[model samples]
Target: MMYISELMTGAPTNERCPLERRMYETLDKLKIPYERVDNDPAASMEECAEVDKVLGTEIRKNVFLCNQKKTTFFLLVMPANKSFDTAAFSKKLGVSHMSFAPPEKMLKHLGTTPGSASVAGLLVDEDDYVQVIVDKEVAESEWFGCNPGINTSHLKFKTQDLLQKFLPKIHHRARIVDL
Candidate 1:
């Protein structure tokens, strides 16, 4: 069984991976408050349900995608139950083609591997290359939760802090879509 700890406010006192540390650094620098929980990789939605109970909020699914040529990349954050439709997303975003990007790209661009992509990951995107996409429903939510560049750790914060504060500081604006 996965170990889901009770909700703990703020960043962890213990040491963290450089990537995870960098994520917290960014959040702290932005003066954005957050709550976090450490999990066992959180490999499945069922496992995440336990984590969600501790955070008392929905933890969205994050997908890393790329166009047919791999020239354009996207980091999509949407509700966990929302099934991804490549064609539908492309149509709504007015893109020619889109597909799941390889894990290598996730590492190269976001500095994290599979199962961990979030606004926090975008900090390593020095050139601001990847397109950040958030579903309208998710953007409308009051709270946001995702991994801090490490699947083992998940965090909750104000969605407004993500959209209005943290993201803008990184020069990233989410492409808000209904899908």
Candidate 2:
């Protein structure tokens, strides 16, 4: 069974990765109160179902994608249950040849590995190179859920805080998409 820790307020007291630490620091600085749970790495949506049940919010499916030329990168946040239609996403963004970005590029751009990609990684995107696209459904949710920067932990906070505070603090904005 996947071990999901009890609900905790704010960030963890134990040591964490720089990216994870920074995520909490940024949230603290912004006064964005959140609830979190530490768990065995839940990399896939299926693995996250338990975490979601514990947190009382569905964790968003975060995907890192890139254009064929590799000049542009995008971090898409959508419902965990929603399937990603590459062709539809490409058409919606008017970008061609969209495909999942490689792990190395994900690290370079989002400061995360393949299964750990989250909007929180935007903190390391100092250059604002990665464009964040959020699904309309996720954008309208009362609470937003995602990992800090790793797959072993998950967080939930007011969606407003994410849109009005967190993204702005990271110097990025989410472009809402129906997909």
Residue 49 in model 1: shift from native, Å?
A: 1.7
Give the Cα lDDT of each candidate.
0.88, 0.93
Which lDDT tens digits does candidate 1 get at residues 1-179?
88777778777889899889988888998999999988888876667778888998888999899998998999999999889899999888877888999988989999988877777789889898899999999999999988898889998999999999988999899989888
Lowest lDDT 10-residue stretch of candidate 1:
41-50
Total clashing pairs for each candidate: 0, 0
In model 1, how large is the Cα lDDT of residue 9?
Answer: 78
Q: Could you tell me the TM-score of candidate 1?
A: 0.96
TM-score of each: 0.96, 0.98
Cα RMSD, model 1 = 1.0
Quick one: best lDDT, which candidate? 2
